[model samples]
Target chain A: MDKKLEPIVKTMQEKFSAAHEEFRGEVHVFVNPEQIVDALTVLRDEYKFELLSALTAVDYYPQTSPRFHVVYQLTSLANNVSVQVRVPVDGDSPKVPTAARVYATANWRERELLDMFGIEFEGHPDPRRILMPEETEGHPLRKDFPLGYEEPQFTFNFEEIDLRKPYVKE
Target chain B: MGVEQKLGNMGVVTTTLENMVNWSRTNAMWPMLFGLACCAIEMMSAQAPHYDMSRFGMELMRASPRQSDLMIVAGRVSKKMGPVLRRLYDQMPEPKWVIAMGDCASCGGVFNNYAIYQGVDEVVPVDVYVAGCPPRPEALIHGVLTVHEKVKAQKLKDLAKS
Candidate 1:
């Protein structure tokens, strides 16, 4: 693990019983979804990880136990060190405590996670769809979300497509 | 100067109203100053001194749709932007022409997804499709000239029918 991240990882493991792994000189400390806000608050207030550089999620399809891993990459601008906090989320209507109180940037990042991965951030202020249009239905980043496509209009079916295609009548 | 000298004392220069109207419309078409994406850069270059869009009598791009006679859709149209594009198209006066000035505006290019409207034609009628991933300034000039040609061929009787 990176020299700067080691102490923080050790501290998280000791205090919250969070599991951690080190790879390629970087550390990932996995905390329970319910304890995410507390963990993030501790990191920000005590460890000086004031900047939430990124808060995104990864979908792990076929892994029902925990279908998503919401990642929070925190940076300590004063110390020039960055650490990652991960919260594993199960697929069935997964919810996690909001870290907005800990980091202001988490507000928009968490909204994006809600929009893309369908992860609910409890206690998030002004929670709304961030990226996608207001009427968009599914969480686009989810594995089951359809990658909508258009049918190529070849010469053979060009006439057929013209009939069904939603071109402006005027 | 030359026309005056040629006319001499025979001061009658008679022409049909249709010919006069079409000629004036083709000479001074005001395209709306709207740029959606990268293709807009090429469109600007076309308007700049190097390509000199003024030679075709397009002195200035109208900032408002009400004043413009043509719209050059110069980039990808996102779903969110579709309604806005349609609203602007509706605001433009009749006899206005649309030139879909890039692959994205013409047929959604490679962004064949839900986020991007498949083609701007789904929102407004396109008079011409200039095929390029942001075509060169020369290509845009050619598209503008093509629109002029289309205007020239338009029949007054057809305008009345519409």
Candidate 2:
């Protein structure tokens, strides 16, 4: 960590007692779901991490205890530095406070997270599917979602495949 | 007047109605001005100065489906876009030809997942399949030529039957 980030990290540790790690020159802070907005706000207002670079989620499905990890990447134009903040939420009904209050960019990113992982942002301005169609049934990015593969046709199965191939009639 | 007098201007150019109709259709086929993905770039390049697709009488790419007789489906069709594509095909007048202009449009290319339709043929009948991730402009022109050949082989009586 740079000399400038040290004090911010120290303050964050004192305030939230959040676990912090340094990897690839970027600080990673693990915060409770409730403290995500506070941590991000402090990083933005106090530490000069002005930009909300990205807000996305990772699905660690089948591990039901904490199934989703909502990640926020913050960049400081003044300090010329960046940090990642991660908040883990339960699988059964994954919910996190909207970071939109801190970063306006969080609105669409949270919608994408909700669309892909079925994670909910409690105070999201417009909580709807961002990428997938409105009628899409399941969160496609989740590990449990099927790949929906279609068997490839080979010479051996050519005749059978030909018969099964769907063709539109005139 | 001298040449007409010398030749008598009496020669009859006799040909079957099918041959005349098919020849005209093949020579003046107009393609739709629609593109889906990366392959669309190649399609535009084919229409550009270098490849010069206008040489085949395909100079005008009509934006409206009603005026176009050929649809060059130039990329992968997602499940969402599939119905839209079918609707566009439906809007086009009869005797329209569809060219599946890339590996994706022909057989979903590398994206055989749930999102992309396996092939565009599922929605509309394809007259030609141009093979490439994004086929070269020359290859697309060749596909167009192939459609021309198919058109030339059609019988007028068959059109009536359909």
Candidate 3:
């Protein structure tokens, strides 16, 4: 456990009953999906973690119970320290409280999370797809989503590949 | 000075209509300012002082599609950018040529996924395909010269038909 993160973990454990673990000199605090805003607010106001460095999600697909982990990385400029806060949400219709109110940069990160992982950030100021096109149908980052691979053209398969090429003819 | 004086002394030089038109077109091939990804950097480097693209009559990179005669698709074409690429290709006037300059613009490079179009040929007809991850300035110059050669060989009747 980092000495700097010790106080944060102790406060989170006492206040919100959040569980924490340390790995590679970094601390990760696991909090309930609904308690995300509350935990982030406490970290910002009390610990002076004013900068929200990153807000992203990891999809553990095919596992129904709490399948998505929305990870928020916070940085403290004054202390020169950083910590990660993770909130687990159910796979089916995953939803989490918006941290955009606490950190303005979370708005785009939350939008990207929704765009790539299909995890909705409730009460986000502008909830729209950030990376993908507006007409894009599916969340591409999901494990089950197809990669849509196309075979390469080589000397052996040149004729076959050329035939399949979607060339526009006038 | 002697060659210039001799040429000046002669009033006119005769040439075929096809040769004359192809010569003029090849000498002043203005490429459009179209770049999509990292290869765009190489394309710009090709135009810089060291490579000196102006020697081949490609001094001007016109931003408007209407004024350019060549389109150098110089990078990866993402799914979102595919329509825009096609629209730009369509906007160029007749007798225009396309040069796919780099591995990505030529064959989607290493990105064989749903996000990127496999090759730019899927959208527009390519005249010259330069092969390189992001080809060097010399390679781009070679590709430009290849386009010039192709333009030189074009028949007037064939151009009129298109």
Off by over 4 Å in 3: A154-164, A168-170, B1-8
Task: Report the number of the highest-TM-score candidate.
Answer: 3
Query: Which rank order by DockQ, best down to worst?
Result: 3, 1, 2
- Model 1 per-residue lDDT at B110: 88
Show what share of the native A-B interface contacts model 3 retains. Answer: 0.68
Docking class of 3: medium
DockQ of each: 0.55, 0.50, 0.62
lDDT tens string, model 3, B12-126?
A: 6666988878888898899999888888899999889999899988989999999999999999988888888889988999888999989888888899998988888888888
Q: Candidate 1 DockQ category?
A: medium
Evaluate model 1: give its TM-score: 0.91
Runs in model 1 with CA error above 4 Å? Answer: A166-170, B1-12
TM-score, per-candidate, Cα-based: 0.91, 0.92, 0.95
- The C-alpha lDDT values of all candidates are 0.88, 0.88, 0.88
The digit string of per-residue lDDT tens for model 1 on B48-90 reads: 8899899998868998999999999999999779899999999
Model 2: lDDT of residue B136: 99
How many pairs of residues collide in each model? 0, 0, 0
Sorted by TM-score, highest first, which candidate order results?
Answer: 3, 2, 1
